[model samples]
Target: MVECGAKHLIYVSRSAGKSKDDENFLHELQVHGCRTQTFAEDVADSSLIKKVVQNAAKPIAGVIQMSMILKVQGTWNLHNAIPGKDLDFFVLFSSLSGILGQIGQVNYAAANTFLKAFVQYRYSLGLPASVLDISAMADIGYVSNRPSVLAQLRCAGMQMLKEPDVLDALRLAILRSLPTPSAAYETTSTMATGFHSVSNPAHLATAVATDTSILDDEETSGELLAIQIGKQLLTFMLSTESEEELDLGRAPSDMGVDFLVSIEIRNSWRQSFRSEITVLGILNAHSLKDLGKMAAKNLKEKFERRNEAMK
Candidate 1:
């Protein structure tokens, strides 16, 4: 933070620095002309936070919250501590596990997810906030120490970001949330990385089959999604043993897709995409093409403020 031109920094934690390394780090910062203070107080305790702010070297200009369980109550306290209007940036360091969910870290994921919702709340109030949903780091963190952990993440197709990559992301987050909100800039942004390891051909190949990010337009995505759904319907109906035999324009009713099959399709869709298409709705679809269009329309209507109706 000091390297990025922050002169005065107040560090609050449950405990203050007690190690020789900690003293040396503080000395290093001081040598670089950075004013710093460390407060040992529970962020959950609102009264203690009051004291920290009351004795501030300067009125708090910004906040960068490095997160976890403390994020839950700590974030709320911080929100209450400093008025949003006064802040230049309120940045949260969250993990990708918050969005994708991790196997053994339910508490951690939930905490990170809370920060995301908190950011949204702040945004609705027209305050500046940004959450960095960082992936597992390859070096300089806990994951780097555990080979088993690293292997698991690799197998799951998660790319481990290096320190430099993380720093770059942090720089952008701070830059993007500065000064004032703009028409083009999302005031409350979620910056994330490691969703894809583009450098690895094997990883790219594994993700490419269902990855829609490669498509720059939603129209193409909708079309592809429709085709994928249609293929699933074909296999469900047992229309033929081959994908080529499935008629795209043939009505579901003509192909003997009864109420039972419609129910199954509806359930399958709900399981996959949280689709709310009713059994009757599926049966009434004029053709396989219409079914896809119906799904597309449903999506647009459900997610968009304004939508085009199917003729």
Candidate 2:
């Protein structure tokens, strides 16, 4: 907006203080003779947001809603308060989790997903709105801080965007609203579609399609494969010198596994075992050992049912 020669800036946040980066940016804006004011207000609260927007000396031209909460009511209230008639554009910062499920972030994803739907709703009412479902931003933010989660994203084939690139994408999204919320930023790649092993394509291909009924030693084969998957998850999520040394009995959370890591683990199972496991079921696993057992059991049941149908 500063680059576009916005004369006055109204910055709002739940926090009272601005970050060093924010202060520097505001200082630069002021130097350029662009009047600026910061409001310590919760955008989710309709009354607070309405009052702040109403009191602006300059007519509010644009709004960028970045407030994140786990509840739908917050979004609903904010949506009601936004002066669609007065704004040129409304940009909502959404996450890729809304499009693709994330472990331990059901509420976050659902909230963001609502924003996507809300954008469509606004368009139907002839209002200008866009939802930017951003990919993981590298070197900053929640996803990049945790090395384990970042590695998991890489393994799942999610691309990371630099800070400048993200800003550029956001600017473009504001200028042009796309038909689909997912297309808000053409540059940001969507979440990884399916799992692939760089070292061994054959490993994934055969394991994913293995016939349980044909194998004479089904139990042994399943157990070995389960153990292999457990080791793979532990290797990515932990600082393990040796995969063999890692205990299979340790819970994923205990191994420093997070929401994204858990999602990658489930994705791996989905592609490897070709079994339809519920997201809840995957996230609820107590340990890698337990998850592996579930995978093996599901794989066995799938083929057994197929064999029975053929008979």
Q: Which candidate is the best by lDDT?
A: 1
In candidate 2, stretches whose alpha carbon ends up further than 4 angstroms from where it belongs are: 16-21, 144-152, 178-311
Q: For residues 219-305, could you state the per-residue lDDT of candidate 2 as single tens digits?
A: 434444555666667666766546546566667667676777767766766777677666566556676567656766776677668
Model 2 is weakest, by summed lDDT over 10 consecutive residues, at: 187-196
Distance from true position, residue 135, model 2, in Å? Answer: 1.0
Give the lDDT of residue 278 in candidate 1: 88
lDDT of 1: 0.70
Q: Against the correct fold, how does model 2 do in TM-score?
A: 0.53
Prediction-by-prediction clash tally:
0, 0
lDDT of 1 by residue, 279-305 (tens): 888888787776655555554444333
Q: Residue 18 in candidate 2 has what lDDT?
A: 68
